[model samples]
Target: MAEEKQTCYEGSSVQSFQFYLEHSGEHKAILQCVHNLLPGEFKRVAEGKSSLDVLGVGSGGGEVDAQMLTLLQSTVPAVPITADIVEGSSALTDNFKALVAKTTNLQKIPFAWHIMHSEDYEKHVKAKGVKKFDFIHMIQMIYYVDDLAESIKFHHSLLKKNGRLMIIIETAHGGWDTLWKTYKKDLCVHAITEYRSSAEVISCLKSQGLKYEEHVITNAFDISECFNPSSQTGQRLLNFMTAKDNFYQSFTSETRAGILDLLKNKCSTQRDGGVFFNSNLSCILVHA
Candidate 1:
């Protein structure tokens, strides 16, 4: 067996992680996209069945988890829920706890917060000590895993029969796809790894003997203000573009100029007051 990799969140100070969460509205939007794609009947079945147990892998700050819990409560009031958050970051876990404490609806659901890496969660289940969950969610965090197949298999093992593992990823064919594919040389140092697409995920799941339902949700981000040097978003973008060593080293002078030019053009258009960057989010609902 291969050694498990430590999670990104491990050993990070809670304050630093909290700062990331505070600026993570974009991530929250992504979670909302996943929540919208979840099967309605599953919510009903979860409510009608025994207590619904949910596990959120890479659940950062619990903002997304809180939103999903609200949706569950409103849609399936009878399903008693116990949400176990498996987070790698202690700082992020603290932020998640604070968010839970502040949110009334989240308090209604039986919530257990676990500060551990995904591999640890898998090991716990393999020991046959943990209860099977009705739903398992991993949103936007799959890219960090060293072994995607093993991660999926672990999640599959955690589910009760007929339970669903819903994963959302950035598609390889979206507008963001173009940006990452082309600029990763310059961007990889600062930005995260390219995510697996919906098709790739489906194929992988099928290879593991898991049946799944998949869908893509497209959304756009307006970042016109981010391009303007005077605007805060623009300044942020500028700093992000210039601060990373990989970005500066990866692109030729001309290519770097072109990328910045594209950013400027996209950011300045007044018709929408921002550049509309479209993203295709792939949601895979797996039956384990």
Candidate 2:
């Protein structure tokens, strides 16, 4: 185990993230958001516009972005879409580019992909005096941001009138939140990334007096393997969960044991012969 601590973003951790995506209920939650609110919201935003501008923060592999654009197309046919995708990972960018290449549906959407994190994107926008966007979204990516209020305020400012800022994050008081709250000092990842949830976002919006709509998505993930000390996949998943690079082997036995106990008893529950995490999410739509 290494002496130094690291955030989940450290190293080439995309493989573990992909694995987590596949194993978790995150996709289902996204689909729920799309079906329940996004289509109508897209239609509302596009009703009077000849062209739509969208900014996607941390658009990973373009899957959700593609779905959203497809919804936009369905809602308002032949409406021109200009999309700007900002992501930190080149591999995800490559995957997004490949996904776009193979998918015929998004051919009409003119896309500009920027290989940078959200903070850098903000800098670039400030330097370039970027135009306001009709829509902006960040899905499960808020955790990595340096300043929650600044990021929220900046993104909210970028929206055109009657526009929307979409943010999806883990719900506060969920198992993950409890775990982070209990062990953040030892973990040390919170300092780097804020390690927050929907509650913080909502609080920020409320404090900012930003008008918004909230959508709650309840889902769970299989965490049964987390108990297996020898399972490499389990260790990686734990690392991803805690935003720690080497969570299982890097910590003291007491800390690790306590964390495991919290994971089993506090953060998760058992069902269907598997340990399911309380991995709920809240999707907030800040109105501008």
Candidate 3:
């Protein structure tokens, strides 16, 4: 893995994500998945617990955080929650705050925002001698971390008795995985380069002798545009998928063509007269 200075979230990465969300219907898929998991997981953790302390890593937009908090509230209606959200992007943090400000439901829950990455949060807690958390969540944001195992360990250590650490990531053998693996091999070196899935994280947990449960969240995207060589949105979608800026111009004609063929043939399937790429993601609930 070569050292990467820039990430998809840095510049064009944000635009790429937004583009994918608009075109692919992944936003709905994500929310549906989160909604699906909340009831069981929240009930399991909130049982016999009167109050909750939560630490959220990579809590982008805070929409998902709000949802989980709401569910937790419903599970233990009398229990109050104190949430600390970790987000590195100031723009995203502000966006989350704005969303929270607008939502009446989220206003009732107490939130303390930490404008930093997971590692920074670890250090901050250690420095302040912070207590353990009852529930922790890392949503769609682990690709930005340096070491998945170490990060998981750090967050797990912050859990209190009967606490749960929930992690959500794309599956290893999905279209997203294929695109990212190809991108790193051919295009650029991103520091946090590994495109990990729930399977991989499960393996990590098993190796540590930790108990965990896995849930599958299936979704797909219409990547038919990538077949078109001249579509700007297609190229930007490629950039988003690969986390490379101007991906069309970054590679040679031969490489670009090869990448497109890989995405079309290997990553996607022909269905309903469109190319649908199934993104198999998973949510893991861990308890020490």
Q: For candidate 3, lDDT tens digit of each residue in 1-288?
A: 533334335455555666777887765776787777777767777778778899888876676777777777776788778888888766667878998899887787788888766766777788888868989888788777777788888888888888899888988788877877776666436635566767678877988888888887888888888778788878777877766678777789888888888888999888999888868778888995
Candidate 3 lands at a TM-score of: 0.91
Candidate 1 local lDDT, residue 198: 63
For model 2, which pairs clash?
Answer: none
- Cα misplacement distance, residue 231 of candidate 2 (Å): 2.5
Ranked by lDDT, the better of candidates 1 and 2 is 2
> Candidate 2 — worst ten consecutive residues by lDDT sum?
2-11
Ranking of all candidate structures by their TM-score, best first: 2, 3, 1
Give lDDT per model, in order.
Answer: 0.67, 0.83, 0.77
Better of 1 and 2 by TM-score: 2
lDDT tens string, model 1, 1-288?
Answer: 654455554442343344333442456666666566654846644744867888899888777778877777777776678888888777778878898888887877777777777767677767778877888899877866657888998788888866888898867566545565666665544325544556567778889887887776665555565445456554444333333323445567787677766654532233544466555577777877
How do the residues 114-209 of candidate 2 rate in per-residue lDDT, one tens digit apiece?
Answer: 877788889888999987899999998887787899999999989987899999888999987888878878764452444688888999999999
Model 2 whole-model lDDT (C-alpha atoms)? 0.83
